[model samples]
Target chain A: MSSLKTPSTFIEGPTRLGKAELAALVAADIPDGAFVNLGIGQPTLVSNYLAPDSGVTLHTENGMLGMGPEAHGDDVDPDLINAGKIPVTELPGASYFHHADSFAMMRGGHLDICVLGAYQVSARGDLANWHTGEPGAIPAVGGAMDLAIGAKDTFVMMTLQTREGQSKLVEACTYPLTGVGCVSRIYTDVAVFLIDRDGDHGGGGDGSVVVRETHGVTFEELEGLVPVPLRRP
Target chain B: MVTITQSALDAVADIPDGATVLIGGFGPAGQPVELIEALVETGTRDLTVVNNNAGNGDVGLAALIGAGRVRKVICSFPRQHDSHQFDAKYRAGEIELELVPQGNLAERIRAAGAGIGAFFTPTGYGTPLAEGKEVREIDGRHYVLELPIRADYALVKAHRADGVGNLTYRKTARNFGPIMAAAATTTIVQVHEVVPTGAMDPEVVVTPGIYVDRVVVVPTAATPRPEEDQ
Candidate 1:
């Protein structure tokens, strides 16, 4: 991420997981029998790592459940496109509905988990992915806000830092927020954060975030880069 | 109560300029391409249109937007990789946009069709999208009041329709078609095929004929059309 900085002499041979490796890690963590919706961008790659026999159902916002992988030459149907407008295939047990029912599946808490790509995620689990709030920028919210607050657990997939080496996991999001305290976990290149929502840190911004795992960087190094404090889960 | 039309031009002929219309599709999936192309041919302008995305590539809704027929677009996501037509017009301030969250867009349309006046949702709560809206705490959670979106006409594409105009869509393409059909004063549809009355099972009809006003059959792929000779 952001031109891997020259590591200090403290940690020897620190290595980071690639996108595929990180997706595989995320896939392995998903429990079977969960109904999931993966946001359009990099989060779509997680389906590749999921086992075919896995009972997880893919829900595309366009209007279908049991969505399969991308379509091939003969299988391509212009009418069978996903939320990203890319042609896709339908798996067994796939069902179609109107946009109202499709969104109801999400906003009604029927979806177990949703993985979304993010620009910034607050330590308190606030999400800011819809609009960047730049001048003259045409903002498009799509289903990001509904998915963030609707799913039982919202998971964010993104690099921990931006291209300028600014930490994306920040004390607060400067951009327009998608939801407040909605994120449950963040899967990144170097670390996985598990937010303790049950902790009695009400309105204190002291979220007691747990560093479940770390890659490439040591715990202390991560803490130094992160704006918020982290403890081992 | 639906009329079976022979052509897209004839199907959408009565839609007046400046009328509010709901065009169904999430990208090109359920888009009424031929009907929109005919509307472009009709030179209808100053229209308010609603859909999911603004447009995709250079056909269907994109063509309508590029032709300057739309005065405004109320949609969820109006920006995409291939949405250059909308992007350019939007940047030039030639078109107006009312961006709604995806769920709100759908539910608002659904509310209109279901005769609901207004409803509250928690989607944009505490966000900038909720600014200046009526907010109330329901069950300790905040919700914003959203009004229904109604239109004068709705154009949709579907897989099949019965002689009486009961409609069924193919796969993911069913999105917004049924609700838009109900939300509009006149709903026109373009389908690949039309079956005889009673041929479609009552249990299988996604949109009943009562919601549909007109049905036109436009075969996809390269079906040669007769020259528009006066």
Candidate 2:
């Protein structure tokens, strides 16, 4: 196991939940018969923690439905890959279709859940994941925009704070937005946040952010760590 | 009658300069590499090529761009780690790029195939991508108008093809091939093998023969041959 680095701030203390633990938390919340699309990078790990009989049908935007877990060794097929280009297995009732059809499912509001990694999620559930708007950034926006707006519920998986000890759950996203007010839940290493359009914190009436769960931190500690005000659920 | 070309070069000979061509693939998967090589060999220039991602490494569409054949590239992910050629060229203003969001790109091509005029999508609304475009509000949600993307020719790759050009793709390699086939005026496919017309199961054919104009069988492990060897 890799060593955990100490966080710079003591407001919320340090999070003991790593990626696998965070993924497990998210995986446990996905209800049965949910059609889920796991985005690239960290969100893909959610598949590993799902129960064998979870009855969740995984979807890949590249043109696959009913996807199974990641493939290993001899089971890896070069042509059978997810949107991230990683080899994955297909479930018993898996089906393949045209690329356009896959996007139609994504943008047509057919997916029950789409879990994505984010750079920042605003207090009003606005998502800023595709670009940081930094100088010389490549700015490759793949399918995040479609999934963010089209999924029935959008969930973000990331650390609550940046490596520089900045809170990602912000009053306003500094980064370029991928979608406006699309995130429903955020699953971070420190806690789970439920964001809604309640207009509590007064950033032009965007929305309010509330803590739903925490690993080892209290609501006051989390609020103190965050740059903006956060309410309790 | 099945129109089977003797070689990739022969199949691509009729593609004129400045033709709008749709090359199917996401990265290198499902890319008609040999057909791209043939296009390079055919010396077609001033091309507008469309695909999902820009070419990877220094081959396929990247090689074509490096060869100074392409005038413009329409794609979503144009700058991967190995896309140095496109990056340098785009930075130097040698080639033009129209970056589309991946889903929007796919939908545009599919719209052309499905004979749709235009559609409103919420993917690019409230962003730079939605700038200077028609925006509408339906049920208090914003959507931007996106038009269909059609091409004069489409180059695609498939796992197998029937003698009459019915094609079936292999796994995830099917990425943009089927949609590109439908969106182009003339679709040319590179396949591993071509069987009798009735050999393939009708249920498994992803692209029916009506959309395919030419079929070229690419030999496994075949490399670009020198002019002298040819």
Candidate 3:
């Protein structure tokens, strides 16, 4: 055995937080007794990082509440799955309902927080996660639209920039909007930011974006990459 | 006397061409595979299917779409990782698609069951999904007017059913089954077991007999299929 030695390589560029670290950062901010819904992709990892004793209840849009972390190996129950179609275990006091009833809980503003992955988030908090507006792109809207507008706080968990280094946090989203001014905070690999209405009652009171936290990148460095002016409050 | 059919083929024989059908399941847990296979065997054409996702692999709705029986699909998530059939058909312009938000899709079906003409929902408020739809502002929040969606037929799978069609589903497998049963003009269910009318506890029944129009007993997996030997 080669002992699976860790490789030491030097690359000169801005370091970004890994997926697990990003998830842990988002999970730390969730308060106890909060009703939360985790979106399908990278945001689903947030559930795994929640404090073991925390009373946070996870809601799946496919008619389940109090969902636990992803089930593994022999523990996987095919019937008990999450919105992502992965087998999951039910937490204590778990309850199941109809699909419409689950969405009612979502659209009824019963969720305290919802973390989602986005293609782009505008400075005014407009979310565009479903379709990229590219021709021939399969548009699968899923539960994103409902969760974006329904949750009390919608926190986006994604990389700060695209693989091509295009900033996802922009002045205005070029993609089709999922919800207007609905995003509360964004958790990217490089930094975390809280979105607010730009200016003093401009653009329906949806205005500038501000930085709240940074990982390896400085606030100024992150702001330099974004399309919009970043306010440091 | 419950309307129980011995043949899955006979249960779906009455479904005509160009029918809007509601299929129950999240992925494959509660899909009426036998009924779908029977419908495929019957060669019903130009079907408009309504479901959560398109289908999995080469079974269930995907098989039907692969056979070119589906003319259109109205669903929330139609393109899954393994949904190559739908992707191929959709890209080829062989089948039409009406993408709906998941919550909106479920609520539209539920609204049909509840006899609601239309209702305003905040799901697709400011997105492209809200385009060409009526928008209203109540309490300074915008909501889009969504109409009820009814189907000509509903094919659902249940864990068990009473003789009179009272249904109780297993765990998370119960998704969209009860609502689809109520939202269609003719609802047909495939179940593993059928008990006596009063055998099931009243509190456990998810779908009442009144909503269900037909019931069929599905063969258990332990029993071998005749085709398997061939």
Interface RMSD (Å), every candidate? 8.2, 8.1, 7.3
Output DockQ, candidate 1. Answer: 0.47
Candidate 3 achieves a global lDDT of: 0.84
Q: Write the per-residue lDDT of candidate 3 for residues B104-177, one digit (tens) a residue.
A: 99999999999999999988887888899999999987889999999999999888999899998877778899
Per-residue alpha-carbon lDDT of candidate 1 for residues A1-233, written as tens digits (9 for 90 to 100):
01111122232225787899878977887778788998887888899999988899999998999999888788987777777767789998998999999899999999988999899998888999988999889989999989998998888899999999999999889989999888888888988887655453222346667777788988888899889878764
Instruction: Sort the candidates on DockQ, descending order.
Output: 1, 3, 2
**Model 3 chain A: worst 10 consecutive residues (lDDT sum):** A1-10
Against the true chain A, what TM-score does chain A of candidate 1 give? 0.91
Model 1: per-residue Cα lDDT over B29-126, one tens digit each: 78888898899999999999999988877888889999999999999898877788999999999999998999999999999999999999989998
Which is the winner by DockQ between candidate 1 and candidate 2?
Answer: 1
How accurately is candidate 2 docked according to DockQ? 0.39
Best by the DockQ measure: 1
Quantify all predictions' global Cα lDDT against the true fold. Answer: 0.85, 0.82, 0.84
- The residue-level lDDT of candidate 2 at A127 comes to 91
**Model 1 off-target regions past 4 Å?**
A1-14, A200-205, B221-230
Off by over 4 Å in 2: A1-15, A198-206, B221-230
DockQ scores for all predicted structures = 0.47, 0.39, 0.44
Residue B174 local lDDT, model 2: 90
Tell how far residue A86 is off in model 2, in angstroms. 1.5
